[model samples]
Target: MKIRCLIIDDETLAHDVIESYIKEFPLIELVRKCNNAIEALEALQQEGNIQLLFLDIKMPGLSGINLLKSLPKAPDIIFTTAYPQHAVEGFELNAVDYLLKPFSFERFLLAVNKVRHKIELESRSAAAQGYFTVKADKRIHKLNFEDVTYMNSIGDYLKIFLKNGKVIITGETLKSIEESLPSNLFLRIHKSYIVAVSSILYIEGNQLVIAGASLPIGLKYKDQVIDRFA
Candidate 1:
């Protein structure tokens, strides 16, 4: 599979270096290059198929870290920066690898390999057991898709309600989690809620009942929700 990649960095030299290194990997496709966060954000919004991102932490405006925060669903990221001080924060944001500027081609290869391995493992796990993994409460949890009753969004975090009457709260955006879910089994019925299609009991006026809880359907999503059951 070709992994579509976008490079967001201010330095022309950084872009050149990365593009050169990417040529060695037949599976990595360089789709776009942006000099600043604003342009990168536009590209991200316009392109839905980007699988990986090469981002720089320090930029003239709208620092890379802030750009990452703004994205509702970010691609697998590998931070390419000159600053070592931001390493901790980069990893905290779930960066696949933090490559210090002037990194050798070998180092770049290692980071890209990690992304390949991660995608492969997730694909295998999802196909084999219908499970998805998330990090929450300082732990990584492997959860069965069928056990998820519904998910509620609370700012930058999500409260995932389960069939076993338990909730898992994680620092993940609703849009991000929705992208990872199986579209056939889950439906985003509102801006703040995503329900397991099978868990939905019935539809009331502008609302749906799932696991005995009533959740309102956003006006923008009402038509899609109705069509789901129609």
Candidate 2:
């Protein structure tokens, strides 16, 4: 499938440069070019099903982040910016890449290749029957139906708290981790946590102590949580 892409840069030269660069590959199709994020927003509405966006962080009406925020469903964004300060913000939003203004085609290709690799993984994940792999700093952590203890959300990462006190930080969100973990072993007791029924030490009122950490038991999950241990 062709990856439909949109470029939202304030500079005509940058647009032309990207247009030239994309010509090397037949998989990427430039859908539209916008002067700023405002124009890009309107174009996204018209294009409907775009896969990638080459966004400039500093624009006239709406910044790249502001544009992404306004959209109900935003496509993957690769920030094309002159400033180096937005790198932290970009990763926080899970941006695919961050391209400096004077970047070369080689650099741009590297970023695009990363996006392509991500798309391939996402495609595989969609057809994935049940299992999913989580990555920590050094290990390719596997979450088999049996090995899972539970997961807890801490910012963007999830803490896979096991029964034996081994904890792993996965680069996935709470929602993704919940879907991949076995429902019987892992129960989401709060918006921020999912715990193993076997590992739960005890419950007091709305407080749940697991592995010596006090996690609040959300009112909605309280009954199911108690029933899990019962």
Candidate 3:
């Protein structure tokens, strides 16, 4: 399956270079080349979903990093930036790969391969079994998809709270877990949380009354969350 992509950057030359690189592979379809996140968000709203984003860390008003956090359904991101210091934060934001600025086309291909492998593994895993795997203590533990109520992100860790009050905390991004979970059952409510709709008691302001806790609903995700329950 092809990965649909979007390039969000303010530089015209950067957009051209990225577009040229994307054309080298037939598996990628360029949906938009947005000059800013506002334009990108407009495009996303108009066109529906995109699978990946080649985003620049430093941009005009809304930086690429902040853009990811503001999105309702955060897509796979590969941070293409000049600053090496941002690498740690980029990975923390769950970027699939980090491409340092002035990177070659060859290196760009490498990053895409990483994303491709992840997609294939997810597709195969979903097709083969109904269980989701969590890595803990050097081993992968598979949990049935239906047992999870909601997943929370605390700093660099993720906690999976099940229906029976059992939980497992692991160091995986909420994005990866969001991808691994059955899409029909899990909904993204904030930058740091994904909830099973059935587990929600109700919505209070931006918070989800979920399992005796109030989870803040992300600003970008608020409308969809309300629509889902309305």
lDDT (Cα, 0-100) at 53 in candidate 3:
92
Off by over 4 Å in 3: 129-230
The top-ranked prediction according to TM-score is 1
Error of 1 at 95 (Å): 0.5
Measured by lDDT, the strongest candidate is 1
Candidate 3, residues 1-230, lDDT tens digits: the string is 35768998888888888899998976676878999888878876654336799999888999988898898777789888888988998999899999987889999999999988877776666746778889966878888767878888899998989888989889887766766664446677777788887788988887899777889998756766776677
TM-score, structure 2 vs. true: 0.55
Ranking of all candidate structures by their TM-score, best first = 1, 3, 2
Identify the superior model by lDDT, candidate 1 or candidate 2.
Answer: 1
Cα-based lDDT at residue 98, candidate 2:
97
lDDT of 1 by residue, 61-163 (tens): 9999999988876889999998999999999999999999899999999999999988777656555668778889899998888899999988878899999
Q: Candidate 1, which segments miss by more than 4 Å at Cα?
A: 129-178, 181-230
TM-score of each candidate structure, all chains considered together:
0.58, 0.55, 0.56
Q: Stretches of candidate 2 above 4 Å error?
A: 129-230
In angstroms, the error of model 2 at 177 is 23
By summed lDDT, the worst window of 10 consecutive residues in model 3 runs over: 177-186
- How many steric overlaps are in each model, in order? 0, 0, 1
